[model samples]
Target: MTVKNGRRWSTANAYLRPAMKRPNLTVVTHALVHKVLLEGKTAAGIRYERKGNVQEVRAKREVILCAGSVGSPHLLQLSGIGSKAVLEEAGIDLQHELPGVGENLQDHLEFYFQFKCKQPITLNGKLNWFSKGLIGARWLLDRKGLGATNHFESCGFIRSKAGVEWPDLQYHFLPAAMRYDGRSAFDGHGFQVHIGHNKPKSRGWIRAKSASPSDNPEIQFNYLEHEADREGFRDCVRLTREIINQPAFDPFRGDEIQPGNGVVTDAEIDAFVRSAVESAYHPSCSCRMGSDDLAVVDPETRVRGIARLRVVDSSIFPTIPNGNLNSPTIMVAEKAADIIRGKGALSPSDAVVGMDENWLERQRSGSPERVAM
Candidate 1:
């Protein structure tokens, strides 16, 4: 299988770039899937458009959707496998009635506070041409400078209190400020720490705003709706402030730049969080896994009541993972491949790294490999 990162890692770089010489895999680009073509009740192929022309790509054995959360649900709805009401409203014929096709959307909410560092230990201080050139030179020579940073510098998972069974909170440390540049938000600037409730009890939804596949769906997340969640986030922020105030960080301290030095009370912090928080862009649970008919996919990831079709992506995560979804998404694909090839599901840890018993034991003991500030 292709290996780079995950879906965000281009298939060209991960799979095609290395395997162009292989004769078995056919690679196509700029092809947009419009719908799944069914032969009676089983998927026979897919309808796609390219260069303004619609065509079909038939699979001899099966069809799988590797599209991310948004694209995956959109494809399902477009293929007449969504709620009957939505399909009729969009003037599309219904093939399947999976009412939960686009429900249960959840994502990590991130809020950040920027500070003007008194010293030059931050990325914001180096945006100038001179420092940037030096940094580029170092990366060019050694492949290990500022370029090696992956935005989130450190990570940790914690349960809110002692009795909780699973870690509910996640933290990410950053060495720069963050910005929202329209298409998506980004983090940059002075050292900052991001704290989020990893397993939010709250849920949201994604729905088709219109019939056209070109139309982007609406994303409505009711974040921070639970009282316990509010308290947890408040604690996370306060803990971050405490970390910044620690003596180990004194040399890089700077004036508070966001929610500033004046914000201390829970109410003020709540207001700041509501206005400033944005998506960590890790949406999931729209098509959850379960035994109930309301569930979108069965435990094997086969769409309920659908034949010869499967969804192999984040959409099937009954609950979102404790950290970045890239790892889990890859694991799902790997296991799915084995299942499809008649080899059956691989042993838990054999296919996925994080599912190891040792890892779970570490998490259970509250002895995570690392803890973010």
Candidate 2:
């Protein structure tokens, strides 16, 4: 597959055309949520700012917070529903104190193992304006050509090393190399393995700077805070090198442009990871689901102390999923919709998820590095 298509099909403004035609669902623009209006301890409605005017929307049945991980916690804190100390510092009268509101922030962080391509088969040549326009025209005329897919065809779900119980590493192979933000890092044809540990022991948190709703909240993804996480990165680098160096890629593989030849030592790899690693833009679990003390929402997605309030987003994910947040968020939204409609949930799918019992041993079978460790 090639990434001839633009990113995030549902995010573009044009995707809202169908939603805009919905009579019951009113889409508001240029509005910032100021607060969740609460009568005593019950969530009544919401207040927002639009065109310098404060507007209120009353909820007839429930108030669902779908602001996502970062925005959900930020809005919760803005509505005086977070840690007691944080609300006190922000001078907002605490409505409901959920200490875990912004805790347990998790994300899928990745590092690119980029290799320069020996040939011009990659997307580097088609990135210019002329090629882009022709590709776009071809796509607009018929949903085909290089503009159809993300060009991310192959992927691997493997264990990082021996002794792991399951597949803890995820790899996404791209036929072109570039920065995560789409900037070309090298002016040549190349490929990249977007690889990272599926499960990270490191945790982070989000906090509101003040009670102001428009102010951006503080976000910290304390990545690679655990020794195991660092070790996982080391394994990711090594395993990617092993794959790219195989005979299959010998025709296209040129040189390792990312951690290069000098980054062999464990310390060197760790340093490189620390400097180059980036979030896969998949943040979740800031407001986790559970009945535990650290949980911000119950299994039903309701805020503990606030009546008629629910959180329906990835923010309530107990842990980040192994993949991107889009699909999981869709699942969450679907479930929440059923709940909102008062429909009985369908029977469990009972889809069996199996993994090798000796995943770790299997991972390290031919890899001598983990044996020495």
Candidate 3:
């Protein structure tokens, strides 16, 4: 959440800002990179298109690719550095044979488990034009008020069931029932908890449609393709219902707004999840890092079998984490930077983490007090 002074902080502000003044740094925008100019197995530079004009920039030493999950794999494929079959079908001569370049795509999918609120304390009350104007004015004037925050003040992470080593489900509680695009879902006051099966077993892939970079890649995240993921969603619905129906919410809770009380059976829950779930947009693990045959990059972030070329983004993640990709992606770049500088690895933390001793037997250390609905 790296937020301060009422503004969200991003990598550009944190890392790139200071480096902008350095003589060695050059920032280019509004340019479409066509491909990496390769010298046999080594990356020598890049070819790009700017304002309909083609251009090439030669690298003095090496080429570091940080084009992100989708862009990175797509760019690699365009540069003739992907699967032999894929490159041949796309009418590009193969420069390298990395079968895992665009494979192993992963992402998080979540749905808003919404409920009508009997009380008018939620952010639904602030959706009117006048209220929004006031909120905006306050923030612009003093950098304080409802407009200063993303409205996701509460969140939780818990395992879907017992026998799980760690939390596989994540929650983001929002005080309003609305779509991500700000469209209201309810006519009155309501709230929701964005719940998701974080560690999905389902995997998909991204492939280049053609040799042209202008053509978007064929992306598919065969979500819920696995039975375990479907079961996980069922658990998500039931567990979220149990948590939200506690005595704590009894005073303000009115009725379930999504996956309504009528959706009781497993089939019904599955159907609801299938239609309601949305991407969390945390796509990663395309050009995964490893020492295996399918690995695209090696332990040091260097592209496999290719020198002077490296990928420094979430594209190199061995596997997607249970949380957001922002921090993890930053960590990847930071670690790659240290590796490039020939720095030794940092000492691992020896801090102790608290966990329920009976975690293997039960989801919680103690049973939560429950009342029959």
Candidate 4:
């Protein structure tokens, strides 16, 4: 939840805003980079198209590629730096052979478990245009209202079953029952819990469809292709039901609105999951960093066989983390900046993380003794 002053705190606002006045910095808008101009195996500069005019910009020292998970691979393939077979199939001359350029694509998939609310204390009541306008007005005036927050104030992480080393499932609680596109399923008050398996064994790829820069790349996540992922979603449905049925929710909980009360069998759960699951938009690990034959980037984030070029984004992650990639991607950029400046590695922190003492015996610890207010 990277937010500040009631607005999303993005990298552009934090890092690029103050540096816009620097003499050495230049920012281009509405331009599409067509490809990286190469001299043999070294990156010399880039070719771009802006308003139908093609242009080239030469690099003084080196070129750093930060086009992100989808763009990075697509741009690399367009520049003839990817799997030999893939480039040949796309009718592009091969400049370098990196078989892992667009391989090992991964993402998190989730679904909202919605429930009808017996009480009127839910955001669904404020779905009208008048209520939304008022909320927006309040936030614009002082940044102190329902619109100030994303409405996902509560979250939790827990293991799906035994033998798991850490929490594999993540939860985000919302007080409104609506689709991701803002469409309400019913006309009554409701709530939902966004639950998903954080770690999945499924893998997929992204490939260039053609040599044209304007052509969209082909992406296939192949989610739930593994038996463990299917089992994990079944655990998600059952475990979410257990949490929602607690005594604390008895006063407000009504009938189940999603997947319904009749969807109880294993086959039914699988069918529901297959139809209901949506992408969490955490695509990563396409250009993995390592020393293996399939590795596209090396330990220093540089392209394995290419000189004066590097990748600095989530695509360089050797493996996806258990949580969102936002913070980790920021950390990667900061570390890459330091490395590029020839700075020494920062000392590792000795912070101790808390864990359940009985974690080996149970999936989760018992509820703490609640004290009345």
Provide the TM-score for each candidate, comma-separated. 0.83, 0.91, 0.97, 0.96
lDDT of each: 0.74, 0.85, 0.90, 0.91
Clashes of 4: 0
Global CA lDDT computed for model 4: 0.91
Candidate 1 lDDT tens digits, 1-373: 1223222355446656788788987777898878788876688889988899999989888888878788887788888888888778777778889898888777787777666566656666666679879987877776666754555657676655445566677777767765533232223336666677777878777777666677777777778887776777776677667657777777777777776878789998888888888788898888888887668888788888889888988988887788778778777877777877768654555464333244433434423343431
Residues 157-212, candidate 3, lDDT per residue (tens digit)? Answer: 88888888888899999999999779656789999999999898898888998999
Q: Per-residue error at 281 for model 4, in Å? A: 0.8
C-alpha lDDT of candidate 3 relative to the true structure = 0.90
Tens digit per residue, CA lDDT, model 4, 1-373 = 7778988789998889889999999999899999999999999999999999999999998999999999998899999999999999888889999999999998999999999999998999998999999999999999878988888889988898866778999999999899977865568999999999989999999999899999999999889999999999999999999889878999999999997899999999999999999998899999999999999998889998999999999999877788888899999999999988999998999999977776677777666464111
RMSD of 3: 1.9
Model 1, C-alpha of 233: deviation from truth (Å): 1.9
> Could you tell me which 10 consecutive residues in candidate 2 have the lowest summed lDDT?
364-373
User: How big is the positional error of residue 122 in model 4, measured in Å on the Cα after superposition?
Assistant: 0.7
Going through the candidates in the order shown, the clash numbers are: 5, 11, 0, 0
When 2 and 3 are scored with TM-score, the better candidate is 3
Colliding residue pairs in candidate 4 = none
Of the two candidates 1 and 2, the one with more favorable lDDT, higher being better, is 2
Q: Identify the candidate with maximal TM-score.
A: 3
Taking all chains together, the TM-score of candidate 3 against the true structure is: 0.97
